[model samples]
Target: MEQRLLAAQALGENELLDLASQRAKAVENWLLEKGHVSKERLFVLAPKVEAATEPGKDGMKARFALK
Candidate 1:
């Protein structure tokens, strides 16, 4: 009888722990969604392309060129 009771108690504890973990995950996802909802929209503009010839030097300014 005591052994059976202990087994039942362990099962109940495991279920409670699992429920708590799921609840925590639900709360985290909710918070993340809310945060994303409030975030600003990101805009990707065309890269700044300098003219290959400036008025004074006639040289290309590779300011935005990665390579």
Candidate 2:
């Protein structure tokens, strides 16, 4: 999934990004259908993609966090 996202970002394809967003939303929907509530889990949808090319910033961005 990360690979696909990276590819989509690199290609600057909005269709791919939109598709990814839909898939992510589908996961959230699936969780809700399974009786999993928001309080029981953390979800950060459509987060900013950390540039893989950025120096010394590999996997440094937090996608989800507790507040």
Candidate 3:
């Protein structure tokens, strides 16, 4: 996953997300197949795309919060 992320760093947003989603799905499938986690406990999440805020252009700002 680290390697993938590093390789994908130069990719555009949509492509990077698609690659990450694919990797996540693969991991989920492997966990399910190995009985490491149950289907009821683990879920596959659908990807969501949010509009990017362009500061100074649209009077919108980008913010990220870490919990």
Candidate number achieving the greatest lDDT relative to the actual structure: 3
Cα lDDT tens digits for candidate 2, 26-61: 666776778566745846356343345687654323
Clashing pairs in 1: none
Minimal lDDT window, size 10, model 2 = 58-67
Candidate order, TM-score descending = 3, 2, 1
The C-alpha local distance difference test score for the whole of candidate 1 amounts to 0.43
Backbone collisions counted per model: 0, 0, 0
Query: Of the pair 2 and 3, which is ahead by TM-score?
Result: 3
TM-score for all predictions? 0.36, 0.42, 0.48
Off by over 4 Å in 2: 1-12, 47-67
TM-score of 3: 0.48
Structure candidate 3, residue pairs in collision: none
- Tell me the alpha-carbon RMSD of every candidate: 26.5, 7.1, 9.6
Across 1-67, the per-residue lDDT of candidate 3 in tens digits comes to 9667756654555664676577667777787898578777876565543444665432222222211
Number of the candidate with higher TM-score, 1 or 2: 2
